[model samples]
Target: MRLQIGPNIDNGRVRLDFRKSPDRPQSTPSYEIEQTKADEFVKKYNSQEKKLFNMTMIFVAAFSMLGWITSIYKRSILWGILGIPGGVIAGLGVGAMISSNKKNNLMDKYNVKEVTKN
Candidate 1:
């Protein structure tokens, strides 16, 4: 198993490559298996991420709306002003943490290593 971090214009991009033997010119059957597994894993991971993103957006909107309504009801502009940043920060932070942990766990399960360049 090998993980390659792209260079130059693709910096910070991690790509998975499967090879049975570096010296061999042809790929082995196991390479196909690894590739398929990786493909499926990527598809599942992306789907879950999309769902998480949508949920986070919803949460942020709801929180912001609630804050705005509360501020109006109480006749204070502070709450309304705070809602936008508060919602965005909280929503994105929690989403990022969850996504990171989930990615790490999935990588371990799939025997994949994440490599960083520089």
Candidate 2:
């Protein structure tokens, strides 16, 4: 069985697809859920994603500022130059980790998964 919870390509509405066989073509979706339920899931997901992105940007800004201040205090150009990329890398890493956990939790809550016959 395969379960999909995301936007539909045709109308951009959140859709839930449940298929008895994983090998079935995309054109055929065995079961479809109500719009309200799918919409709720999509709204939660999008909100979480937005929050993640905002937090990441905040981290980047904070790190960059901290680096700049340190460079000024230490009188080292290297610190200032390294700040931007360092901030970006750190922010992305942190964001990705948090995002993964949140998505997993959300999926679990919604009981969305794929099962294959062995």
Q: What clash count goes with each model?
A: 0, 0
Candidate 2, residues 69-105, lDDT tens digits: the string is 7777888779778866776787777777877788778
Lowest summed lDDT across 10 adjacent residues in model 1 is found at 27-36
Candidate 2, after superposition: displacement of residue 20 in Å?
Answer: 24
Model 2 residue 74 CA deviation in Å: 2.1
Q: What are the lDDT scores of the predictions, listed in order?
A: 0.56, 0.62
Summarize candidate 1's per-residue lDDT along 7-76 as a digit string, tens digits.
Answer: 2223233355333456644532121114435566666655676776777777677766766677778776
Clash pairs detected, candidate 1: none
In candidate 2, clashing pairs total 0
Error of 2 at 117 (Å): 16
Mind sharing the TM-score for model 1?
0.57
**Stretches of candidate 2 above 4 Å error?**
1-37, 114-118
